[model samples]
Target: MINIWAIGMVIALIVTTIIVSIMGKRATANTADFYLAGRKVGFFTNASAICGDYFSAASFLGVAAAVYASGLDGAWFAAGFGAAFVPVVLFMASPIRRFGEYTIPDFLFARYGQSHRARIIGVVMVQLISIFYLAPQMVGAGTTWNVLVGQGLFGLSPYATGVWVVVLIMTLYVALGGMKGTTWNQLIQFWVLFTAMILVVIMGIVNGVGYSDSVAKNSEKPLLNPGKVTVAKLMEGEPGKRLYDVNQKNMTPEAFAKVQAVVDKGDPTAEVNILVPQKNKLHPERAMMFNEPGHRYSALDQFSMVLALVLGTAGLPHVMNRYYTNPSGKSARFTTVWVLGFVALFYMMSQYVGAIARQIIPPEVAKDPELMKLTVDGLLLKADQVMPVMGKIFAGEFGLGYVAAGAFAAMFSTIGGLLMASAASWGHDIYENYVNPHAEEWKRVLVGKIAVVGMATLSLLVGLGIPAAGLDKAYPALIAMMVTWAFSVSASAFVPTLLASIWWKKTTEKGALAGMFSGGFGAIFFIVMNILKETKAVAPDSFFATLGTLTFPVLITVPLSFAVIFIVSITDKKLPANVEQIWMRIHGTAAERRERRMQQMVLQPEQK
Candidate 1:
């Protein structure tokens, strides 16, 4: 019963991570090296690291899981994720690198009048996005551990055990290795996930699963989901026309008997799990189809979802912070280009992997006893599990090991970046500047390491708390869904203000503040309301209930944030005195020219 392959994979990952951290710790002696890899990462290496940072458990497990659950609607997660970098390349990348700072907060605070208030706000926004983004990766850690270990260590649940274990691993690596270490680990991790995905796709094709044909066939039937409904809910309506009757027609005798037993117990609250037909919110007149729109999102939500994702990539503090690590502004732009190709290919293969899961999973689930535990009448009980389950079906426990390792890699890589960003925002941006401006270099680096631990601990608690809050049960693909919320917040709060700072010289601190609060908090309000409604905590007739119904609020928040910035900036007209100089720093290549000259001098042969 012991999964030696899975355990071996985890051990290998742990050992490699520890070794890298030790080496990186030796190399890291100052704040610059700790926070931004001493601003020495090359274009391609930075791109690979960015890919690893950007593709969280959300991409590795959730994208495929979303596709498996919601059909065509889920495919948009990949499209939106890939398209996000285009705006980054065209708009934000050059400015972010050219401005030349260790973190996004540093750049924003410096750009907007050098106010302490602005720095504090930037720190809050960084925490909001990083924590939101960090939680799902932790969820992935717990879920992967559940599958690998099948039991908990000590007296804790398997999920809690996973959260504690993974957090320790991440804290040790990021704290000790710093950006220099994580960058190298991220580069290696990206390839591991990419290879795992490619192998799944190629192996599926070789196993005689026709990609397009299978999807076409899948679309022919209404999508079915595993559902758990109480006896009272299932028994509603007329006899033979109730939810129970509809469910019974598709259920096996063994499954039906279990349901009947629950009903016969006379407990209205007793629940039974069965396959249920999915409804299309976009088109209520039509049945949900695998190839058509509207299983996870409504008509308006489709646009909002895409908007958040595309704009959000440019706004992510952790991802944007990486631009500062680039050797040059031009190299930063080139990094975005490489990121586009790398992520696009990974998502394409992920979609293929998801599509093939539908063909491969159901047929194999009934035969494998271990696999049966993950399914309900052969359909996956949780969509986030699609990749690993498919991996096992293809190549047994060894395949599970491969995919599970990839899942952890995805989580560890992203969490490491988030921790670095969080640390820089706190230790570098807040502690070094305001709390202890005159602190020694060693003290500054020590603070960063401490911040890493603090953030990791916070993330662990959030991970453990998610299940207790029932947030994990509120969505079909919670990993992908939760990450989108983070994207929505980043897009609405940061993107407009960031754009104005770079292009609009008239942007006052007040205007930036207005935009940040209006967009950032607005997104948060809607997200919290949505979660409330989803968990059935909000009254159906309440005003908040209406707001909560939206799956994505970016359509309202993004434009509103931009509009607030424009109006406030025009009225305030309190630009920084050195506005022209700041603008030049963003667009000019003086830094690049100086660096080029220095490099040329270094390259010149010494006269003997």
Candidate 2:
């Protein structure tokens, strides 16, 4: 009953984390060391850490799950996630590194003529985005825990137990080790998870699961989703048939018989979980097939979701913060390039893993009682469980152990970075600058540690509350869906203004403030309303109904923020007096050029 191999692997991971934290602890002596790892992380090391940080619960579990559950439409998550970094490399990476700031808010303050208003607004947006992003990781922790551990201690459910354990580990290590520890661990974490995924893909091919062949085989049947409907709704339709006919046509005999048994008892309120033909949400007139494109997004949403994923990468505070760790602008650019390649390969293999599970899981689910609870006629109840379940199917306990450890690495690495980012925004950006400008170095570091624990506590509470909010039931893979929402928020809140700040001299502090408020709050409002609509908490008609349908608001919010900043700056026309000087620094003009030349001169003299 106990999985000794799985437990052993987990213990090994924990031991490695502890060892890395101790190493980081010895290295961290000042705020600079704690937050940016002494600003000396190499391109390759930082690149690997960036992959670990970027590949959250959403990337690790959600990408493959999405492919498994929704077919080709789901592959867009990976495509969008990978494409996001391109803009970062072309637009943000070099300029941000050249700007030389500890956080996004720090950049905003200097760019906008040292306005506290801009700094404060930046902090608000950072924390808001971090919270939205962190919540999914918490939910993911619970979701993965349900599959790997399968049970809870004390009075907690399996989900809650997972959240608690992962959150505590993140808080402890991040607080103890700082960025130096986190960077090295992330570098290590990326490879562990990356290697595990490689093994799963290789093993699948060796076991007769070809990528093209597996996809073709799975697409042969009408794509069906296992869902529940009320008996009352099923009993309504036409003179001869009604709504009941639609479901009955798709349900298997065994599933239909179960529904009939409930109907015979005359219970209109009863619910039945039955397989229904998956509808093409994008093109309702088209058929829903596993290899097809219209399974999830509409014509409008396709573009909207793509924009959210692409622009959103530049906006993530935790991710943006990593750019500061680079020693130079060139290093930052190199890191982004490396990250793109690593994530692209990881995503490709993950989709194949999903396809293999699609072909293999159902047959095995019937034979294993433990696997039964995770699936419905071999289809996963929550698609996020695909990786570990597929692991067990592929190689029993040993395979499960490898994938489970990877899942843990994914969650811990990203969550740890988020915890550190939140700490820096609060402790370094706010407390160090405003709360105690004269505080000792020890006091400042202590505040950062305190912030880490506080964020970890908040994440734990969010983990427990996800199911209570009905978010778990509202989406097929909530881990991925929630993460996309966070991306939408960050893109809406940060990217437009950041671009304007670096490129346009007229981007006044007032304009930045107005833009942040409009875009940041607008994204959050749209996401909340959509969630409410999905959970059946709010019923909308006409205009509200159309707005509620938008799952990714970046299509509207990103442009709106850009427009607001442009119009407001034109009207205000109040540029900073030192605007030209700051421009040179940001764009590597005379000021930055002089600095670089002087640095080269000093090095040449030493060499002579």
Candidate 3:
């Protein structure tokens, strides 16, 4: 059954993109205009656009899904995400803009005495972080498509169809309109996502599914505990294993048996849910509170997750590029303030939506014949589907379509920004600097467009392969988890180097290079090891498992990166000769730089 309403929303998105592209085309004639929107973005407009880029599908769908699946631990993800802006405002924003670079790599190259090595490393790190970040947005796109359209096209799976369509649309949006178009589109997207979440919350409350009621109902049910379960095959001598969850042991033996019997008859390779006794057992009938911890993370994991989110935000390449779009340092600071406010509002509503979802569609109802038929595989809602399921329940099909549009907006807005960042890095940092140092403005812009298309195609191919790679199954609510790895890499590879370069005049190019390689590779290595362990290629209790868990490798890699940079800089005495001049450029006021330039201009005739 085709959904006319959903199709209408997609058409609306297409029309809006065309109009924005036309407008952006008028202003996008030079590199500055294309990459930074002429550096004239207003405070609120930039702020809103930053929110759109920052939120992504992880914030739109993943945060709520995390909350629904993991209780309070999920809410912490939102908190860390929101809190990250504080460090940006305090440490990065003003100086980054004052330095006045086209991209993060641009800043690094300038600060390191115009080294091509710095530029190349910066581009590599940017692409690494951007690609990791881009994948989740693609996954979210696919998940949204499956729930909304629920159909395949030309023999492609719904997931593949979504990835292809979104990538195609966003590639055009970035390649045609450039940064100006992406910023304007993001401004509109943020509001759409914000309003959709607000409406869901309001409707949920009006329908007697408010926060308090949600908490009450959630507390009355035993939480599902996930682990490996061995199942006996009907055929003798055959055995199988699966990931399954059994509820708290508070349930009576008879009740437990009934649930187990149902599970025994189901597919042994699939996830199964059963009831058991509660851990506390003090009040067997009373359930755990909604705010309780230990649902998903151990104490150590919680701390690690928070650490990754807080530090990672500072290092994200796409986000850092947005700060460069500000007209001045003051404007950049103001943008961060506004981003904090916007992010806080979104997260608060998102968690409430997650809680409301639990109330509207409880775990017990997951097995109901009618509800089962409505889900992806005639089973419980996937973690990413929590928010959409709530939409379908609270509103009708139209509501589902509306929310689906909002979800796509979230993915498209972020993807556009990411593609633009990647293009700028490739065109300006690599091509202009290395391939054609004397390239004209038009030539540079052409190269950027080509880079945009290339990067988008690469990301699309990777996104389409996610389901086939079994990533969606291994990490059920993959948005947050996959995003965290990106964050981990960013924080480990870039944060220490970025902070040191900005604040430490002693930082040498060698130190920065060493730190970037060590930190970036370390994070990637651990993340891959963790994934292998997750897929059961390695033993859980092995030493490698200790380093490779879903919890970020940031804790190890970040400090190691910092230490490497500090030690290398002190040991290598070959600092940039113009350290004082660069310091003034980065730390001095904009007015000072302007005055210096004017004075230099005034003395030029005498010197000649």
Candidate 4:
């Protein structure tokens, strides 16, 4: 069975690639060009590209899915994601660009002076976050592949094929065009995603009205509740179990007693249904009873997508980086405003489409072989697949093709930006500056290109390996968790380094190193501990009760780093003596520099 939908998507991707390649040639090939597109990006263009690169699989598919899954609480993820950028804009963005470094590590090292200790730890944070981030993209690739090609095309597993294909395409694009190609691709893809989303929203509203009217006339709750529900996954383990093989079966005796008590309290003679695996007496094979008809449907009409557009665009990294490509800091700020307007229009449309999917896709359809299994024994279905599933429903074969193509483009654009950013850190901050200071410009650029290819390949392998290793198919959740770690690391390390570089004169190399290390390492430690406790690797019997919450713990670490850095720097008392000169360069007026440059340009032209 040749799926016309899959074929259409392939065609769309090819068209997007050709168009971006043509425009990308406009960017000159040099270190500056490779890294920052020679700092000449205009406002509208960069802003659009930012929106494209920023949206990712999470924002496009994930947000819609989350809204559908959690009812009201899932909205918090989108809100947190978007609002995170406000602090970045007010505090980090302008100063970071002004500091004139390639990676977060580069900025830190530059501000703190060369310390091997800081470099090693910074690399660790980067690798951890990037690897974790890469896993989700890979998992998403598998997911989309499964939906589009798996069932329709061949007997091969959709999950395996999807991961490889998504990684393969992203690798090729990043390897070939570098940053210039990546930016152009992102800019175009952003528009496609936005357009698709708009169509979805419009159709959704129309669907909502029809569903709502039908329910109102019939005195029913059709649109109000999709009526699907399932049990949430609970961590399980036993004493003496290894970390990796802590079987989901094998709950402790105490846990069994607790469950029996609950069962007895309900009714002494009532027959209790438990799906337990044969070996584990306490733990069950399938714990929760599922109900497909009772899951809550979305109240899409009530959401404010307009507010989301504003904050969401601001928080994206790929979008923030685009401003650095602009000629001046002022141009970068202007580009952000442009992004706000463009993204707002597009996001509203996407939201509408997601809403439409909720209205049209029937509750019973989830159990159908071809449709999403939204309710699994009392547990809600994953929300991330809503947009893609909707595409299959409304537009039928054609819509599926369009949505998949757009999604692939979206992934490519964002992944390429990340690869390039990561590569720069390795090449410029680690290799060239620290390992080989005398390296030629051409060699440096070549090294970066090679590093980009290497990173992409490694990420591909890692992404594919994640599910194979039996970490569970919680790919989206894991990826989201890892990105938060990245954000936390950046928030802690970069926040201090940035402030010190631009504002504080007393910041010493020792203090910068301490802050970066402590903040980065401390967060990792806390997250790992929480995860272990959840899995019952650290404690078996009372897993949830044993695991301490992380939010307050994370807050404690940030200040600890800040304090360490400040104290260490003062004690060392050997700070950068020319700190004032460095500050002048970073914080100096652009008008003053431009005025001097204009005078020179005029004088040189007359002399020639």
Highest lDDT against the true fold, candidate: 1
Candidate 3 lDDT trough over 10 residues, lowest sum: 234-243
Runs in model 1 with CA error above 4 Å?
252-257, 260-267, 591-608
Off by over 4 Å in 4: 18-28, 113-124, 151-156, 209-321, 342-359, 363-369, 372-380, 469-482, 533-548, 551-553, 591-608
Q: Which candidate would rank higher by lDDT, 1 or 2?
A: 1
The best-first sequence of candidates by lDDT reads: 1, 2, 3, 4
- Write out the backbone clash pairs for model 3: 248-276, 248-277, 249-276, 249-277, 249-278, 250-277, 250-278
Give one digit per residue, the lDDT tens place, for model 1 in 345-430: 99888888888787788778768889888877677888998888887888788988988888888999999999999999989998
Clashes of 1: 0
Which lDDT tens digits does candidate 3 get at residues 1-608? 55677778867977897689878987778999999999999889999999889889999999998887666777887887878788789899999999999999999899998888988998999999999999999999888888777787899998888998899899888888989988999998888878878878888878776776676767776554222233432122423312122232443454445446756676555443432122322234455445676555555667777888899988898888998889899999989889989988888888888777766764534444445544322223477887766666667667776788789889988998899999999998898888998999999999999999999999998898777777775765689888988989999999999999999989999999999999999999988988877666678899877766655787789999999999999999678888877898898887887787788799998899
Worst 10 residues of 1 by lDDT: 599-608
True-structure Cα RMSD, model 2: 3.9
lDDT of 4 by residue, 313-418 (tens): 3323344456667776676667766765664555444434433344456542644446634422212244466776677666677776777776776677677777
* 350 Cα displacement, candidate 4 (Å): 6.2
lDDT of 2 by residue, 1-608 (tens): 44666778877997899899988998778999999999999999999999999988898889898888888877888789878899999999999998899999999999988889898889899888888898988888887777777889788998999899898888888999999999999988888888878878887888887878878988987787777788887777683454467556755565467668888888888986666577888668766899988776777777888799999989999899999999999899999899889977888887787776788887787689888776655678788988888877888999888888888899888998898899999999899999999999889999999999998888888788989999887888788888999999999999999999988888988888888889999999999888887888876664565677888898899999999999999999998888876887788844667986688799998999
- Give the better candidate number (1 or 3) by TM-score: 1
Question: For every model shown, what is its TM-score relative to the native structure?
Answer: 0.95, 0.94, 0.89, 0.74
Better of 1 and 4 by lDDT: 1
